[model samples]
Target: MHKQLLLIGLLLLVLTVQGQNLWREGEMQVRVYVENQAQADFLKRSNMIGEPAGAFIRCYLTPDELLHIRQQGIRYEVEVDDLNKMSASMGSRGVPNGYYTVAQLHAIADSLEQNFPDICKVVHLGFATGMNELKAIKISDNVHLNENEAGILFDGGIHGDELGGPENLIRFARDLCYGYNNDAQITNLINNREIWIYYCVNPYGRKYMTRYNANGVDLNRDFGYMWNGEGNSSGPFSQPESKIYRNLMLNNQFVIHCSYHSGTEYISYPWSYRAQSTPDAQHHLMLAQMYSQSSGYTNLPYGQGYNGMYAINGSTKDFGYGALGSISWTIELSVSKQPPAAQIVPIYLKNKAAMLKMVEMAGYGIQGVVRDSITNLPIPALVFVNDFMCVTNNPVVGDFHKFLPGGSYTVKVVAAGHQTRVYENVVVQDNQATTLDVVLPRDTGRYAWRVISTHIAGNNPHDEGNTMGALGPPDNIRYSLGKNGYAIIDMCDTLKPGNGPEIKVFENDQTPENYMVMAGATPDGPWILMGHGTGNQEFELEPSGLQQARYLKIKDSGTGQSQIPDAGFDLDAISYVYRPATDTSGIIEGFTYIDWNVLIEKAPGTEIYYRDQVVYSDENAYFRFQADTGSFAMDAIWEMYGYANCPVHLSPQQHLYLNIIMEWMEPVETIAANNSITLYPNPGRDKVAIKSLTNNPLLSLLLCNAQGAVVHRIMNPQMNVDGEILLNVSTLKPGLYIVVGIDETGKSASGKLLIQ
Candidate 1:
């Protein structure tokens, strides 16, 4: 009894010192024995680190936290009293001797890109808190292009202390890059699929041999979907690392996403925040089982994360599966973090076959493209398989792939600006794929066309509905804004307020739930409250004092139990009150191309801007918009390549067509030498002059703002005998501008100008 008391007092003293330090040093790994769900919940609330074994759960806790656990009378055993010291004792400072360091990993990626330029390229994905470059490598037949292929992402090192994941990922990447044409299966997979490898996610944590980033946030718990502020996350996707991950997932349509870790040997998938299985739980299980079977580990297990491990919120696997519709999961490589140097190669060899199999399986299942029935162009659409939801087609290729067990299922395709289509009894085989190309007719209704891609909030994976439910016309299907959750809806066209209610909110169910309707000129809004209502109702913008709005933010009034289904307002759709243009609207249609002279390759992703409205060119390089009849400057920008600007004058009911040729811009020195054009008084406060050394007569002069918008135009400008044209710039803003002179022969010369 005396010894026990002394031990307790010593533990208290250590904890007190640690509490004062505030975890500036590191954390301690502990095994807390639990007898019931309540104990497990307590550990989970304390940010459990690894899966629970028979009678205890393992977690990394600061001394302060351990003291609190002891105060609660929870029996625990200290596995590693100082995780940082243990990590240091494992090998070196950055990583184990055999394991690749963060800098070495980046150098390897660079080497791969340099050696196999045709099959590999490195993509710089933002930076970490410690200014380490977060990078990924793309391996495919056409690595530089976004081809219509099944995309799969394999990432590791999210927890820097998990040394084996990065080692496995880097080895896999090297094998894939080196075995391109030498290996048959590898060559075939490379030719047919796009593989992404993000080797190290937390360089700072890896460098310091810690579990969290420099900011002490666990990146795995920083994702946005169903986020609940666990693992020291300030908010959903609040960290720069999480934001980079979010952007990467949102920009690409990945069919399968695997995040690598090391703490135990298991394959865990989806619904990490709750015990309920995902709607695609069967599919997830089938894949996990296949992966386990393929791996060299004879007793590797696979199951749902919540039950197999413990409940967690804002996990990468959950975000990937719930928000992006990817077959996402975590592959815990070893039973120990930072395994011995001799064990690194053996561990990687064990999971290598399984990783390759995953890449191969990515191409299996339902594969097809969604397109416009009238235009015969590809459409970016969301695909639903019966009760399962949230799969999407690649915006660039309009192609989608979903892996499912051998069975017949219902498939539904929904796209913005198009009618929804459904197919019953779509048959898919176990090992084979089925193609079901769909062409949807256009929907001409005045409704919110698309849900703002990234602004969805208050999403619960356990709910019956998804974000897509708030799209299109009211068809009974709806997304529940779970207790204060909000979704920003994008009206493809602006809503002009004239008389009665200009916007209508549709609540599918009969429940009289209350919600607030707000309007914004942009997606990220300082929202102006239009009005409030219950159930299906109409709102007028007159009270909000807004003339026009392109975005609507609908927030559920926080009421009812959040854990229940449809806890708050159920939103079916939002519609706009359409008032026909009273002889004031005109259409602007155009095609964007790289170069009209040489092979005219259509630039599909070009941004076309008119006034404050911006639209992207479709798959066919075609874009059309209706605008109020007036003189407006228009521009088309192909990012990193070049931009084209023009002055427009619209008459009522006029349908003007243009062909925007975006030529690749050469270096300024090259352009000046090639075009023989010079500008005098370049940084002038009042005026500047442009002269052509070749004596090329100028037909017109255009002054473009920094954003490539044409602000001023001069037709038939007079020039002196020296072939120089003088331009006045006193009225322009004090910024850099591009002065473009078009010769009579249509040859153009550009020079930079600055105004004070």
Candidate 2:
């Protein structure tokens, strides 16, 4: 009897821990009648499923919730009394036989990548809460490269119970890959555009057949924009799934993005949290019309999400449009959440052409690259078309595409460390893309240039002002860091510890408010507190023990009332105080090379370290910085391995040039045996000579300090008849240095040199 009781207790505990599935034994699917947004909000508070539609909202409610609805005097009609039984009658506890399971879908993607190696490649997005790998298939001509091409994304299965979406996505991906060479339209699109299909976003939810993920949080409501603590979301993007999704969107500049759904047949666009239409309302409507017309359905209703369906915060559509400016939306495929197995193919067939049309239209707008005028290299910039704003370019390729109606409009380009450029009356044509390449000169001002791409704006309920106000110059217009609110801004250029004050904070108006400022090297920061201040003030970075910082976080000190307009700290702007280069400071300019030959392409993003300061080369592989005159060891790092050089002595007001060549680190034993180079006067100071024993001529020599920093370099040195190359090491500090020599055939030889 005791053993039976223990067994029963364990069974009950297991069921309790699992919480709610798609349908419980006594749960009922009901249509609730709501008079206004207030009633809709009330239903949401009751923890109901799905959003409101027109005067009625369909949802699954428990017996207790149904009784509460009656007590609240809300009218509701029961659609399905026993949801579990009804679902069982449709098929089984899991998906029907025709529907593909999560494992099967992943297998299909893997097989496609294997079969079509040229155009299809599987990209591992991230792991889900259940430890299942989230994957996306990229379809393009050059699948491996991040080319300057318009990108589009399609994703499905955010809600696990909505099964049709994943099926549609996987099928579409398969079709695109198979039709690449056979179909002309598909071939053209595959050649010109980069298409991404993220099938099965919520693998845990799909496997369990539940609306929520493994943690029981609704993935759809966990986005970071205008989040209001709905659907058990602990915070904005708190869940792993949402974090991975956010990274994908921010990393790629996708022109058009579509998220699939079921339980309703409609097309919904942005402004889901508010009633106001998006600035590109006409453009959204036009695309919706085109998509619907191309699809199998006729007269498919489409409109703004707020009224078209219902108001909701932290939705993927809103995040994609409001934050990143992608043409993003959700497509409701069927009236049934999980339709019968046989209807899956017909439903996919209905929307296949419309998906292709979206890919085609994604390139039909204004497309261009934003670059630096001086270096002629790509840069990330904000492109504003009249009133509609979008982050146009990415740092990798610096290409941007925006779908616009055919008309004349003002186009403004803004970038960090660059002057804002405006093009008046930039005309775009119908069904065709217009090129508007822009080159911005460097900005000499000291003001903070741009806001970090991603951040949580902990806005107060009453007065949550725009964070963009804190960017650019000091205008009277400011962003209010509401009671205990905060924001992160980017300086775009590194700010170092200078002679006097290195930073300035501008508070709007005469009202002085308390705030704390912190700085970090990256956006996700282990922040070092700068100081606390009231109102406008100048701060010195020297006190913080930080060598340099490019990102700043400012927070209100929670001194003001909780509910008030422009409460807490009102920040007008933040800037770096520039001091003229002194005679003690010396400038170093150089390029990072992949090979010793100057004709070869330069390597970008190589890290150059001198003393406590580190800087990365730009897209053109050029790096320039001014540092205080001193004898310091310099190191060039690539892929976390340091390549050493001789010590450098920077004289006052000296202008030095360097070319750092990155080489792979070989085994110590192998490096000593191969190439066969010898160094003489190992313990002597002033100079070192390198003589190669190999047949190849020694073309260049690099002398490094004990710390593996390249301190001295001799390129195209005059080799004697005995094949010996001399290096002037008089300026190098007395230490054990490593000498690396490059042969004419690009082979490398290494030897140790002791300078005393």
Candidate 3:
């Protein structure tokens, strides 16, 4: 009794000094580093507040503190790591011991496939950079997984060194397949859903015991979805781990792809697209809420990106929903799950139950493809869902992807700048799939600009309020043209502070005196500083007169023109001459993309006509007009009279092509008298053609169609030469058009010839 009181008094003293850092009912566990014995005692007491039996305290202590405890021989339950102890704890029968090596993992996956003939198969998703073999075990029972009610995909070992996730994942699979017939809940979960177990999404990382894959690319960050800012795994499937999993996940209709990572213990949902609320955020929140209730894990909405703890801006979850349309999440497996591994079985087991319940929870589905609308050619477009509540946003790319629950989603596309498009009401049905094919328009337009040089913000200078402001540009317009390739902004004129970022300008064709000039990054050159940070820290460059360029590149110069470069640079935004407004006021809504800098190779002659309709082109290489009929798209053989099959595609990236295929045109009617017909050059050279009376007056003409409709006409005076006439067939697309003519005698004659 006296000892108990002393211990209780000590705990109270600890509590008095250290605030209440206890695990409330269902609260997640994060390691705590107390300052003193009192604080440690308080933490020790609160660690058991709502913790059930068999739980332990794992302190992340300083070397000094560890020494103090060890030297004094203090009696307390705490530890750092016990690799062997963790490896020894086994699950149900048929469940092999956990391992830490890549070879061991492969062997285990292979054995599981062979042992469980009814429900699992080992598949080689892809090979690694070092030519190392990478594979996974797909555990299922329904021979072919035919029409299961739901799909639950579990991917682990994204952060390679985080071995806890792999262990839990293997255990879950073992429990599901092995425990199905034996355990009721397990049986039910397996029967209702095709729970896909994808252990070691980043096998190469796991093999090396590193956090990133062999490519030095973080596996969890490789998804091609939600790819702006710090989003996506180092460049889509660039890492072996992310590649195989991406291929696997995109092919399957998963309701929930609950991936695992260690270091922190939290069940976080989507919106990794950017650090803001997405259109499907409510759904994610609801899932988070459900997760909290189902798993009884404290939910923290802070930094979610591997970059930090805050729910990231562009992540797998972001692309999952924004790109593939799957409700995905990054479930941080705790480093707090102690050793003597058996102590964690319950945690993994409980999560298994929670995951099973989540599978049954409501989920929205999404499906899509990127293809050239005209030629039906598939081109990759960066895609994403824009949430109204965001400071910044970017697009997701690649083929099909997935996210959390679905609902009304707005898909915004940004590729070769062919008029950024948006698809609203991209509705997603629950427990089902929605297919969307994104058609990329051809590029051809005026004022169609690409990024030029990047320097300091133009607004950096002025009578503005900035004291220590030396990095940003001065004045409003100091855009000077240098013989070399930098659009030198004159900031010494009207400089100030509290401005925007550093920027620069250049023409796409100008060869930089130094491609490595101002653009110096950590790795190397060809760097260009765009926009970055807030108004106070970034460099801002003003637009020069007629900003005529396609690709101007710039990099951060240690010049007093912009923000302090952290790590590599402060490049945060890209500026081009795109209609910066959603609501555009124009004669034609079809926007144009042009490189005023790229000199035109062709000179304009008289109005070029196609099918007798005058087609116009601007100074730049772009043409625009509106049409009521005809399905427009990109890439096709434009058969006009004599241009020798000109291959035409859209610029600014093409939108809709209203091609007039005279041959495919539906037969209508014709007026032949003054509307009669005439043919140019009696028996012409390349094209033997005829014209409607709409062409000349001297020679009369007539025509008929399969529908008995007079299709053409021509007159006499409109002709010249050897008593015949020269037929202006240059504008006629290769096809048939009737020609009838009458003389002073009022008698009509008709002739027919095919034009190539």
Candidate 4:
């Protein structure tokens, strides 16, 4: 009898510890400030992975921890206990009154299968770590068989206390099954797409009225992406709940995925570990906009995650995108975890359209097959259109789908050890899917440099949409102040080519400024500063212990002396010399212009006079003469349609500036014709030698500023003096200027002059 009493005492102690594991209902939760990754790391060591609050991060702390934080002089405040709440307050709004019991949910699933056997099937998707069954209701025309149709998976209740998740998913499934043939759009989506609806992922937590699973783990934070062995879970996939979903992602091809939650009305996208733009940013933004517009919920702007609500690592949405390449999204369904019972149905009805629309968009792009030419068998490959985006074919079926805006695209198919195939002028029409089947051949040549992505920062009005290979010294240059501007160049694969990593940037003219060169695998980088230099010059970025790198970000360091106002480092062309570049002439060239109106002016100026106003027409360029300070701002405004149009605003201190400046005739034209005036060593450090190619004696030469104001003049220069008439250009500031020469025969020629 004494032993039995001792066992009972131990059992009571275990129960008390279990109670302490959970956040108490109605208990106040405080958000403690974390200054940097170090402070965040401290909080993370204490199990606060998903509770990021503001600029840096926020640590949700217990009362004792809160006091410790205060004592440590850490800033903190008590906000609404988002996790803990009164049970009586739950389901108080006009929503489903009571939470679903485990048995009741199973019964509902069973009923769904029984009632809609033709289009729905209930399947048990393994079990959570707590041993609670995870269930899903799959709705499709042929629910029992696998189809080539696009697949979409929707799941909720990854957070146990967020009842809106499971309830909304359950209701959406029920509505889809019920409205299948009766509703036209529902019938269309069901027939075309395979939909999987998973409800109540954390059943043990839900059953016990807790915020975590039976093991006190947050299932949503247990994915492998950015999982740092912190938070409530021991490691990635440590919880069976996360393992089940991970398995599902690996085994099936889900084109679209959504994870539902509550506490805010938002639709969040990826890069949860760090704030970076998703690789499929455009597609994610388009679909997110569609979902938000259809549901009328707040759409977090593109390139932002969780509405900057928090910095959560190892999240479900991030895992789906970072690992599986699925276009995943997170939906914060309501302001409360559990809204009033009466509001549940209303919320379900409101989000119904978005749920259906998301699935529809999965199949609304170009879909096709990739195959082996010799064997005539399906082969997995990558499909690229619009240089920025790429989609891979399924391994089993060799099928690929790419959603794109309506336009003519040159679809390129690439596979390992295979010669890439290019299809030209493949038109993708609105609401139509274009099919293109490609068969790759064996490659016969050695590997070479291939551009993966390109990004530029500054006010460049043209050539922004061009690929890295197509960008060069002839293209429009982006000019900004100091180190405020930058560019990102990505390669097709990481390069560790033994020794001497070389990078080259081609500029339109010689303007010296220091640039910070960095290398990494991603854009939001823990960047490594590799080199710093002036002007457009070749850089060697070889550093010790750093071998493989696929991304290069260049920032203006503003270390070199500059004669041009606010002129940072400008790049016209860039290349990574991995294997001695084979071709360097694909550099695309366009007319350069500056638009003065959009310039972010530092000081007040008077509107001088206007010449051209229409975009990219005869008057696409303008000159703004600053009377207050004898400086001119030249702007090139063009209707280049799809190109990045950055308004050119030249600083007053920059003497040689033009809003729009393009050579009327090619420089080579002067060489082709005998009647030419040549300026040797165009970017002269001190003196420039000018020669008259024709027999006519040199008449007069006038040097004018960007605004046509004469800066210097010379008359009757002796022909062939010092082999060529040497002009002193050391007094002139560095910038673009005009050189006009007139002969005795009334013949005249004008050429661009560069002062360096």
Candidate 5:
């Protein structure tokens, strides 16, 4: 009898310990604060929102989101208890550890390493605005997982006001660590792909209880894809918080990005450029459906700006995917506020399972950014494109988007006052940056017939598109016809609409050169030239309407070194416009989300081109292109019945690395030589001086240095002269320079200036 009794006691002790361990695994150490108990009571009342159980009504609120409950004239804050916090019977610095304070939550960061311990590092991402070190413990077990993911970026709490996200992320991380050994799928994802997670993208915003970051900038809307800072200034790139993130994003090769946000429940993607249904709209919607089904979350009205929720600019999602070429999405957590610890824990557990699966479920594909052609700024707008057309409402907590199946695609970004920009056949074989910078013309395309802008400037006898007159970036110069040289130069700032009649290019006899000046109401100008011996000459009508009466220096393509002599009958007109039927360039007109096996080969470094621009491509033959910013279609210019046309298609999320093959063609090169002039030193190595006999004033001088910076200037911007204006390049370093001259009227001419 005594022996049996002792054995029973031993068995009971074992059961007691096992029971304690189970209790510990399911502990809910949380605290809530209210102005009084009234508001807390109200939250407690709503706590019965999701599901019900004993002891906890489910006040599903992260501290920040919980704070919102105060709208009823009440105040509140919430927190979760961690094991480390349970150890310090006394608060570390006024706050006890046995109780989870914000500090202890941070302390847990050191514990979680990468998915593959040997491959990545376990470290801190950055700090929040409150200066709280936002810590993360990445548990990378290469022995269990392989994480060379095309790239993955995940962040939470950009809107300090949206607190649930970060808190939920914490829960997600916690569950992953504790459940790793038991969870088979979780282990697989971590090991196979490289996943970067930043719990609390903007902690300062949360601590201060403000919607913006430390610098008062909306961290969510800072990338300059289609950025309009004055309208939506999150902060300058110089902000420490922003800089830290910017540095990471710019360097990250992650293919997909998921930013957590609250106040609404939805999975929005693409075409934030103008809040419109992109060519890939359906496709993106499909992916959102998948996320919704998997995560048990709701999808709200996405892609709507201030027009829907509020008209804002500089959103991270659009910028990340458009400018950086990363597929990005904004995951709005819950439709309701915070629940109690018991309620929150289960919800968190559920969400963790859902999101981990969602990330895994979001497949691969091509993604990129849509920036202002001139400013290189990110614009907050909807995006659309073809190949595997996709449209996602991406939130910018950090990374761009998920991995791709290694392929190519065409992307289009649209917004007001900008041209219908298109990128044809962009390829993404691996993690490569396809900095597809898009140029948007001012919004009046309706009053605007067309935009014939170019990185290339038309003739003054140098190359295909331009002379020294229209030098590209690194230098912002505008040019026109001038004396002693084919093109005259001017400053960018000083040259605006109707600001010309400033530059003069006259004949050797001081006679206003025989030139007929033609101006357009918009960029797609019906240009009229007044000179002789005209031949092949390229021209670009600005995408935006022309500042009245702008002029360009047009000298003959020149058969010889001498300026083409006028045969007296020298006046012709030419006009180029968008193929006026479908209001587009080319469209993807197909499905996105391709399978890798369909790809020709998993190579890298291939290229996609539209007209003369190399827009997209990868090593393998995977790529797509865009034509309409309004539609996600690309410029796959196909001609029929003497007119060129392109169709528009939309994309969906989860349908990444699309195998959507596009069909496109080139329009026969057409240049109507209205009228031409003359120039000397045709290919002059040292100083190929010029003398234009055209009668147009210089408006702007677009010049570029060897490093692509504008080096010289001739302010008036008019070439109503016929003499020599030596370009004093003694200050210019020895290298190739593109010198340009624009008349006060906006006529341009460019040439190559070499320095030995």
Candidate 6:
């Protein structure tokens, strides 16, 4: 009994000390709403907040600075006043209630190991400056040995106050181990991958409910890559907690990693210090999109430069990427710091599929061995695709994992004291891992080739404009009348015919169309026909014998058939496939992705025009679409679009464009309210009443069958004394019909009319 009391006293004293050191001298978290860019810039200049949530910037301020802000008449609200009190309050809620205390967390970890001895093992990851032991769990078929499989690390509670991370990770580990026999997905993931979940990376701050460690250092900002600010006492890795992970990462190989945090619900990838895009932007986006889509969370890819969020440096994800070759990402779990216990399971369930998907994706891409030709021993070599700069190989296993969006690439494998091996025409399929193992011979001469630059001909103005739909500049622009519109691309330098095809043309291949490719040394071409292609597919230039040229022209044959008027062949991008010099950045320099929400917010004149009439003046329409669409268990639009009511994906870019078009065209809410097309007794048994609440006279009302055939037509409908037009839907078959109303201004609104 005395020992228990002594232990309790020690815990109380520790908490007291941690609470005192939390804010240190002056610190308070505030959420300030800024009206314009100037106000945002003002907060930025002060260096208070790292990122912004739309117009609201979350700031950690001092008392003196808080006074200055109020004096400046800046509007602000306190998010957390006293860190100690918040921590204390969080502790009172107990394990899974709000957050678990250090003792409670340790107990939970111990329980997990005891409960699932077959698959789970708790690992103590050394200790922090506060003498608290950091821990993680290893779950796999054989956790005792280095398995010949991909490695995944799920880290949480990097920041002390971010309770959701650790909580969700604990629950996930439990589910994976508990449901192994019953759940097929869990069984597959555990059997295939070596998974590690570090429940809390920073235990010191977790005790105090602060963002920083015991030494007043933010562990996240203590990494080697792009680290800013003065190191606390112990220099870089001076913090014992960071040093442990750093050493572990250096020694082991982790192919994929996801770091969890709270504050905002987002998925941010590597290269956060600069505005430059990652080499594997496409792959990262595919995974990031899948993660958010799986969780039904907001999808934001890459970093602040593209996302409009604030720039964060020296983060765990960047360290894992820049220092190690792991494709690490940071997932902001929720908007709240420590979500209630009831919300924890729901949040985990939402993220469970995404977690499984990440593991599955890691198992994908190209996986193979790099070895010596004679010895047949593994050689730690750098495997690289010319297009993406940062993506490399896992040195420990001599295996390279490269996930490229469906295309062909020139793969180069290089190692110290060895001849570089070059594999030409390596084809990568989407969502599938391709294997290519190569043996490097002794050191030889370096192969060199100039980088080719692409430019469209200025003469074809209509053919090169980005605004004519083909999904901005990256996907290029659209062109119609197959024979009339042709785009000529200048390669900037003379091209020599290599082993395989030298040029690639992106086309809207949905319709049966053929494009004629002609090449010449100059723009005023004495041209030769390179080849012809059909369908909505990328056209690769297969040079015959030894053909070489600096200019390539893609012309529509007009022989291509299309039912839609003016819908000829649409060109996306034209690039020459050149053997690149040393793998470097700036190969394909352009934004490859754009989020739908960001488009709605930033695009000028972004009014939604419905069927060339009734422009939606409200922004809520976008929100409604984002939330309403998508399937319950699925994270992506692919599953969502599978429903009968959902849109179709002819092409990813065009599908999004068409969805936006449909969002504007379909009289969802804005049109139904403004244009006033109201149908009473919606699931009408016999007769349905229609009302037009607009000043414009109702010109015509048409009722169409499920196949869109005109079943009933009311010409020049007259309103009754009560301002409602009664329609006899009784004669219509007991099925679904489209109710379309035309106004005097030629504005048309459509809704569903059901007959039973």
Ranked by lDDT, the better of candidates 2 and 5 is 2
Q: For model 3, how does the per-residue alpha-carbon lDDT over 401-465 read when each residue is reduced to its tens digit?
A: 34435577776654433345678888876645666656665442111111111222211222211
TM-score of each: 0.71, 0.71, 0.42, 0.52, 0.39, 0.54
Question: Model-by-model lDDT, in order?
Answer: 0.76, 0.75, 0.42, 0.59, 0.40, 0.58
Q: Report the Cα RMSD per candidate.
A: 12.8, 12.4, 21.5, 26.0, 26.5, 28.8
lDDT of 4 by residue, 1-756 (tens): 699998887687567644654553334446566555555545544555344323333344556666666766767677555445443244333123565666687788889999999788887788775457888888998675444567789988787767787778888888889988799999999998889988878887676555677676777777765454545666556777887887676545577888887766767787665545665777788888888888845443333573464556568887777555578878877766667767778878778888888888888667786764432334446566755435556643457776665778888776643577778899988767788877675442212122222222222223222222223223443433323445455443454433344566555465566677777754334578777766666666566234556666667674543333444566555555433221222211133432233442211121222111212323322333322122222222222211111223233344434333322222222322235556655545687777665656668887776444567889987655444678889989997666767677645555555676
| TM-score winner, 2 or 6 | 2
Alpha carbon lDDT at 421, candidate 1: 81
Off by over 4 Å in 5: 1-102, 114-120, 126-130, 134-148, 178-181, 230-238, 298-309, 336-338, 366-756
Candidate 5 has its poorest 10 consecutive residues by lDDT at 447-456
Which candidate, 2 or 5, would have the higher TM-score against the true structure? Answer: 2
| lDDT order of candidates, top first | 1, 2, 4, 6, 3, 5
| Model 5 lDDT per residue over 1-756, tens place | 699998887687556533432112323323333434464345433421111111122233334434455456543223344322332232323222122335545655544443324433445556554345665444444422212233466777776645566677666666666656577886666554456667666665554344455455566545443333421353324245554665465545445667777554555565443434433445445555555666644433444232132223345665555434455667766644333334445555546655775556443444344433322233333344453322322211111233344456666554433565667777765433343434464442211111112111111222111122132111221222222123211111111222112222222222223333234332223443432322222232222244333333333232332222331212122212222122233333232222233442222332332222344344344455544323222322112101112223433221223343332211222111121222223222344344332346544454465223454556754333445443444455665555555544433444444454
Worst 10 residues of 3 by lDDT: 389-398
**In terms of TM-score, how similar is model 5 to the real structure?**
0.39
Runs in model 6 with CA error above 4 Å? 1-20, 34-46, 49-51, 67-75, 88-98, 114-118, 230-235, 296-306, 391-396, 444-756
Worst 10 residues of 4 by lDDT: 603-612
The residue-by-residue lDDT of candidate 6 on 468-550, one tens digit each, is 22211223334443343454444433455534455555564455567677787754455677788764443333443324676
Candidate number with greatest TM-score: 1
Model 6 vs. true fold: TM: 0.54
Question: Which consecutive 10 residues in model 2 have the weakest lDDT in total?
Answer: 452-461
Better of 5 and 6 by lDDT: 6
Q: Report the alpha-carbon TM-score of model 3 versus the true structure.
A: 0.42
What tens digits encode model 1's per-residue C-alpha lDDT throughout 631-737?
65666677656556666777888998977887654422233324644665545577777776557788888787644567899999999876778888889989767
